[model samples]
Target: MTLPAKAIGAAAFAVAAGLSILAAVWAASAIEGKSLRGVRAALEEGGYTWAEVAVDGLQVTLTGTAPTESLRFRALTAAGAVVDARRIIDAMDVVDPSALGVPEFTLEILRNGDGISLIGLVPSEGAHAAIVERLGDLAGDGQVTDMLETSEHAEPEGWGAAVDFGLRAMEALPRSKISVTASRVAVMAISDSAAEKARIESDLRRRTPQGVTLSLDISAPRPVIAPFTLRFVMDKAGARFDACSANNEKARDRIVAAATKAGMAGKVNCTIGLGVPSPDWAEAVAMGIAATAQLGDAVITYSDADVSLVAASGVAPDLFDRVVGELESNLPEVFSLHAVLTPAEASETRDGGIPEFVAILREDGKVELRGRVPDPLVREAVESFARSRFGSTAVYAATRLDAGLPKGWSIRALAAVDALAHLDSGQVTVRADRVKISGTTSQPDGRDEVARILSDKLGEAQGIEIAISYVPVEVPEVDLPSPEECVEGINAALTRQKIEFEPGSARIAPSASGTLDTIADLLKDCADAPIEVAGHTDSQGSEEMNLNLSRSRAQSVVQALMGRRVLTGNLSAVGYGETLPIAPNDTEDGREQNRRIEFRLLRIAEDGTTVPMALIPGPDTPRPKARPGGSDSAEPAASE
Candidate 1:
C-alpha cells in the first residue's frame, strides 16, 4: 500500500524489524520452553524440587535455593546432561548456612540382659565406626541394635561433646535408660543400693560435658527394718536413740523434741520408715520418751506396736506408777504398754526367776554375749553397739529372749559395757541387780572406776563387784647373743684345755681325760653355740697319715664330751689335717704346737655368712662341728 519512496522505505524497514523480533522470540522459546524446561523437569523429577531454570535467547539459567552445595552443583550437572555443557548458566543460589535452630537431635540407648540399643540421629562429623566399635566391645556376647541417621549439616555447637558424654555415662549406668540430645541427657534407672545410687550420681557428675544439661532419676527402696523398732537410752552421757523410726516428719519432730528435752546432746537422726502403726506414731513415741525420762535413767523401746518402758533400779515405785499411768492414758488407740520399775540393784531384792546375762571376752579378740536380752529392739541395738564398739568381725551375740529380766538389767548391762572399756580382758555377768566384772587393766583406779560407773548408772543398793587386777608394766625381754658372741666364747674355752693322744695313734690317752672333762664342762655351758673341733697335725709323719691320725684323735674328744652328757646337737668335728697348722712343722716346740688340736668358733649367720669368731669363750653357749678330741674308751675310728 506504499505509494511514495519514503513510505515504501519505512514499510520495508518495519517488516524487516518484525521478522527479526520473531526470530529472537523463536530462539528464546526454544531454549526456555524445551531445554530449560526439560532441565527443570529433570531436577524436579530427580527429587530436587528446589531448582528453577530460566532462559534468555540461547542462554539457559538456574535460580532458586539449593539446600546444600552438593545439590547446587548437581543442578549444574543436570542441566549439562540435558544440553551442551557450555550452555548451562548456573545462577542458582544456595541457602544461607545457619546454626541449627533447635538442633532437636535425639538419641535413645537401651541396655538390658539381651543387649544394647542405639537409635537416633548423629552428626556427620562423629566417627560412627569408632562409636560402633566401642558399642560392640560393651555389647560383648550380647547383641546391639543400631538404627541411626546422620545429618549432612554441621553439628550445632557442643553437640559432639554432649553425645560423647552421654556414651560414657551409659557405660557407668548399665541398667539405665538414657535419652541423649544435642543439649540435654536424661538418665532413668534403678540402683541396687544406696551406695550404688551415690556411685551413679558421682559418675554422671564427673563425666557430663560442661555445656550439656543432665538429669538423673535413680531410685533405691528403703532398707527393711524387721520387727520395726525404736531404742532410746538415757544416761550420764545424755539421752540418745540407738535407732529411731518414724512414719512421717511430724511424728519424727515430736519424738525428737521429746528426746531433746530428755537430754539428747548430739545430732539425732531418726529414720523415716513405712508401716507406722498409725498416724499418731509421733504422739505415741513422744509421750513414751518423755514419760520414761521422768523416771530417771531409763530405756524406752518399741517392737511394732508393743511399747516397753523400763526404769533404773532405784526409781521410786510410786513415781514409776504415776508416769506409767500418764503414758498409757496419753498413748494412741493402737498402742499397748508394758512398764517395769527395776528392783533395787541389791542382789537380795532381785527376782530369782530370771537368769543373768553373761558377756565373755576371749584372748582371740572375740566378745560373746548370751543369756537375756530385753526385747527385739534392745537386742538388735546391743548387738550393733557391740559389733561397732568391739570389732565388726569379732563380736557375737547369742542372747536369748527374756523380757522377764529384772527392771534394772539393761541399765546394769550398759554400765558393764562402760566398765569393759577399762579392762584389757574380762567377763561381765549381769544378774538381777548385781554386776560382776572381772578383768585386768593397767589403770590403777580401774576397779574403783568400774564400781563407780556401775553405781552411778544403777544408783544406791547396786552391787557391782570389780574383781579387777592391775597389770604391772611388762618387762623387756633379754635378747640372746648373736652367733658371733657365741663363737668368741667357745674359742676361749678350747684354749684353756688341750687333748693328749697316745703315740702315733688316733687314741686319746688317759691323761687327756682331765682336759676332756674341762672341755666338756665348757661345752655344757655353751650348748647352743656351734663348736668346730678342728684337728691340726705336725709334719712328723706322712701328711696323709698324720691327717688321718689327727682326725681320729678329734673324734675321740667328741666321744668323751658325749660321754660327759654334754649336748652335741650343734657340735660338729672337721679335720683340717696338716693344712691349717697353727705352728711351723720345722722346730720341735713349733711342731709340738703345730701337732696341737685347735678349736675355732664358727658363726653361721642367717644369710649363711661364715665368720671365725676368735672367741675367748666368754659366758655364752658354744656349739661344735664334727670333731674328735678325746678317746675316753679306746682307739676311735677316724673320718678325714
Candidate 2:
C-alpha cells in the first residue's frame, strides 16, 4: 500500500490497460455470438443447416456450405445486419438445387428511388405481374421497375381474348407499351410518342403469350401529287379564219358577219383558202385586172382580199355588182372596165376557142382546160405530138376517158378532146370502146389538136371488136406444227398406260411394269426427244419428308431409265412433291392417283428422230395395289 507517486501512476495505467484488453475481447465475443445467432436464424428460415458464421469486431464472415448461392447470400446478409458489420466476407459453397433434386425459383428485385426493376424468366404474364405486385407491396409507395424475362409458355385456349383485353388497356394509355416474352406479356409507357405507338403496341400485347417483344418506333409523315395530262388540237377553220381577217376593213366586215352568224369565235385556229374568182368569167377577169392594177397581184392574191361575190354571206350577185359599179364610178381612173365573161360562141362550144382559153388563166400563170371530145384517134395524135414537143417532164398523163363507141374510133374530136383535158396525171379508167385522153399539158391548144386527130381517125374505123385483159399476182403461205398437238400426244401416251398408284407411296407394283414397258417403248420411239421426269406427291406427311420422298422416287425412275440404256443426259428428274399433284387428295383414290411420276417432252428435233433419252419420263409411274396376302398386284398389259 505504501508506494511512490510514479509507481502509483504506473499501477493505475497497467490496470486501465488490462481493463481495455478485457473489453476488446468481450466485444469480439459478443459480435461473434450475435453473428452466429443471425446465421442460425437465416439457415433455419432458408432451410439450410450446414452453413457457418464468424465475426471479428464489426466485420462479419459466412463460411461452410449452403443449398444454393441465394441461400449463402441470405445467410451472410442476415449475419451482417445483426452485427452492424463494417464488412462481410463470404466463404460459403453454393449447392445447385437442380443437382440436389430440388425445385428452384429465382427471384430478383431492383429499386432506384421511386423506380423498381425486375428481371427473370417467368412462366406466365399473370405470375410475372403477381411477383411485381408483391414487390410493389413490399416497397410500399416506391415505383416498381420490371425487366422480367419469360419462358415461351403457350397461351391457354381461351386466353387470347384476355390478351386482347390487356392490349386494349395498354392502348388506352398515351405512353403505354406492351410486349411478349415467353407466354408472358410486359407493359410499360413513359413518353409523348406513346399514343401513336399505342396502336402497334396494342396489337402486340397479350395476357398469355410467348416470343420476342414487338416495338413501334414510327415518327414521320408522307407526301402526294395530282395524276393526269390535258391536251388539244387547233381547228384552223371557221371562227379562226374570221379572227385572222378582223383587221382588214373589207375582208373583216365579211368575215366578222359570217362569224356572228356562225356564233363561234376565239376558240381555235382558222385556215382560209382563196375561193374561185367569179361566177361571170368575163366580169371576174375585168375585176381582177383592176384589183391587180391598184393593189398589185400579190395583195389581190392574199386570199382574204380575193373573196368572191358568189361566196359572200348575205350578198346577192346583183347587190355585189352594184357595190362594185358604184366604186368603179367614183374611182374610174383607178379601175378598168372589161368583160370578165368568155366569148358567147366559146361558152356554147364544148371545147373553148382561143379567146375562152385565155380568159381562164389562173393568177399563178397556170390554166386548167376541162371538156369532153368525140374522136379517139385525134386524142392519141395530139397527146403524142404534145409529148414529143414538151418531153415527159413538161407533159404528164392525168387520166383517160372511155366513151362507149366502136373500137379504133378517132379521139381527136371536140367531145373527145374536152374529156381528155379534165383528167388527172397517171389516171386511167376504162369504159366502152371510145377512149378520151386527158391530162395537163405545156401548151393550152393541146386538147384542141388532140380532138382534131381523133376526128380524122374515127373517119377511118368502120367496125371492130376488142377485149380487156389484166394479170393476177399470187403469194405463198407458211406451215408450222401446233404446240397443242405435241402436248396432246404426251397426254395420250400417259393415259394409254392406265396404271394406278396407292396412297402416299411411290412404289410401282409388279402389275404396273407392263405400263412402264409401254412407256419405255414410247421413249424408244422418240429417241431424239428430250424428256423431263417429274415426281409429284399429294399433300401428306411433313413438307420436308414429302419433298425428300418425291425426289428419291424421281431419282429411282431416272436410274431405271438409264438401266434401259436411255442416255443419262437426255433424261432429267425433278421432284415437285405436293406442289404439282394432278389429282385431288381429299379422297383415298384421288390421293393414290395424285402421288405419281410423269414424263414430259421438253423438245424435239426437226428430223423427228435422234430423240434424247433424257427427255423420257422415268419409270417412277404409279405403284400397283397390294394383294391380300401382302404380295404386290400385277399390272395389266398396256395394250389391254
Candidate 3:
C-alpha cells in the first residue's frame, strides 16, 4: 500500500532488499544440489560403495563405515576431485582389522585301488594346481581326484614336510587313508600278506619327517589254518616234524632239537604264528616225538594241546607204557596226552605147548608161585630165588614138580622172580620155549630190564616177552599245595588278561571268554580247592547298579567255569562292586584296570573257624595281596 512521498522512498528500498535476499537463497540451494551430484558421481566412479556422501552449501561430508582405512582414504580423494580437497569432510569409520580373522586349515587324502582323492582346507600359497601337480608326480598311473579349497592364512611350520611325508607314505600304502595336519600325519594301510604289511610299516616309519608325528596302522589278512594242526611222525626209517607250529624262536629251536633227537632227519620248517597254548610248546612237542620214537612203528599227532600217540600192536607192552607215562608226566601243564598201546599180536599171546611157569606179586607185598617148576632141585632153587629177591616172609610156593620142564627152566624162573621183585605189583610167566614178564613199576626202564636179566641167566638163548608199565606220581600229588598258593597263581594269570564285561551291561564280552578258558583250565588242577570268584567294577554308575552288575558277572564266571567241566562244588562267586577299586577311576586307563576279577582261597579249621592262608614267595608262588578274615560272601575281601 502506497502512502506519501517519504513512505514511498522507504517502500522502494525494502522491496529491493527483499528481492536480493530471495535470489541469494535460490542460488545457494542450486550450488548445494550441484555439489551433492558431483561428489556422488566421483564416489561411484572410484568404487567406494560403503562410503556415505552429503552436501550442505559448498562443503561435502562423509558418514558411512568403510571396509578398510585404505578404502576410506580413496573415497575422500575421489570427493576432492570434484571440489577443493579441504572442502571434503571425512567422518567414515573403518572396521577393526582383527574382525577379519586368520583361516583354519585341514586336509584329508584318501587312497584306494581305484585311485586317490583329496579334500579339505589348505593354505592358498600353492593354490590347488601345485598340490595336484605334486600328487600326479608321486601317484603315477593312479587316478587323482583334486577337490581342494584354500584360505589366506600363512602355512604353518613343518606343514610342507608333513604333507610330503604323508603323500610318500600313501604311495607305499596302496589301500589307505591319510589325515594330514600341521604337525601330525596319520597313515592306515592294508597289505595282502604280513610280510608286505611289515614292509609298509617299516617304510612309512623311515620316511616320516622329523618334527612330524606319524601314526601308522598297517594290516594284513589273517592266515587261514585249515585245521590248525601239527603232526610229528617217527618210524623205523627215521623221524620228521610236519606242520609244526612254534610259538616263538626259542620254541622252534627246542622242537627241532627234539625231532632230530628222535631221528627227525633233514631241515625242519616250523611255522610260527598266533595259535599256541603255552610257552613250553617246544619242550612238550619234543617229548611227544620222543615217546613216539620209543614205539617202533607209530604216529603221534597234536591238535592244539591235545596229543595222541599210536604204536603198532607188536611193540613191547612195557616199553610202550613206560614211554607214554614219561611223556604224560613230562608234558607242560597246558598239554593233555592220549596214548593207545595196542595189545601184542594174537600169535604172541598163544601158548607154545611148552612147560610154563608163572609168578605173581601182589600189591600187598606177597609173592605167589604157580605153573610148572622143574624137578625138586630146580623148584627149590626157584623158590629160594624168590625168597632172596622179595624177603622170605613174603614168598609162598604154589608150584607142582614136573620133570617135563625145559633145560633152562630153573635159570629162567630165578631170573623172572628177580625181575618181578622190582615191580610194585606184577606177574612173571616163564616157559621152556619163552618167558613173558609183565608188571607195573616206578622205574623208568623197568620194562626193558627183564630181557637183559634172562639173557644173562640163560646164556643169551632165552627170549623174554616183556609187558611192563611205569606210572609217575600224579601232580599236585597226594599232598596238595596250600590254598594260598592256588589263589596266587590264579591272580597272576588274571593280571595277563582281565575278565571284561559289555559296556553299561553285566554280560561278559566275547574277548573275555579266552581269559575264562585259561581260568577254567587252572581250576581243573584245583578240583579239591575252595576258591572264591570275586567280581569288581569301576566307579562309573550308582552303587546299587554296580553291585548288581558285579554279582551277575561273578555268577556268570562261575557258571562258565562249570560249563568247561570245572568242579564248582568247592567254588563260589561274590561281588565287591565299586567299593574295592584297584586304581583311580578318573582316567580311562585307570577305569579299565579298576574293573577286574579276583580269586581267593578259603580255608576252614576243624572247629569251623575261617583260617587265613599264606604262602612263601618264590618262582613257584605269587605274593598274596592280603589274608582274608572270612569267606567270599557278603563280607569285605582282604584286598582288591
Please give the clash total of every predicted structure, in order: 27, 70, 2
Please tell me which model should have the higher lDDT, number 1 or number 3: 3
List the global CA lDDT of all models.
Answer: 0.69, 0.42, 0.71
For all predicted structures, in order, the TM-scores are 0.42, 0.19, 0.28
Compared with the true structure, what per-residue lDDT tens digits does model 1 show for residues 1-640? 6399988899999999999999988877775688867787788778888877777666787888888788888878877888787877777788766733534667788887548888877655244443555566667799988887666565677765666667667776668788887779999887877657976797687657778899999876565544456767665656766457777677778888888898787666566656666777787888888886887677677766777777877778889889999998988898888876666544432545447778787766688888787788777777777777688898888887777666766767666666676677899988875577887876543554555465446653344455667685564644555545555555565566557677788788787777776666666555555556666788877767877776667776666676676544355565656766667778888877776766556564443445335522235646434223321221211111
Stretches off by above 4 angstroms in model 3 are: 1-104, 125-127, 137-142, 231-640
Model 3: per-residue Cα lDDT over 278-299, one tens digit each: 6677777778777777786676
lDDT of 2 by residue, 514-616 (tens): 6655665555444334456666677988776777677667666655554454333435555666766567889988877777777665544343432223333
Shift of residue 380 alpha carbon in model 2, Å: 99
Output the lDDT of residue 635, model 2. Answer: 13
Can you rank all candidates by TM-score, best first?
1, 3, 2
Q: What RMSD, rounded to one decimal, does every model reach? A: 27.0, 30.5, 29.9
lDDT, candidate 1, equals 0.69
C-alpha lDDT of candidate 2 relative to the true structure: 0.42
Instruction: Kindly indicate the candidate among 1 and 2 with the higher TM-score.
Output: 1
Q: Which should have the higher lDDT, number 2 or number 3?
A: 3
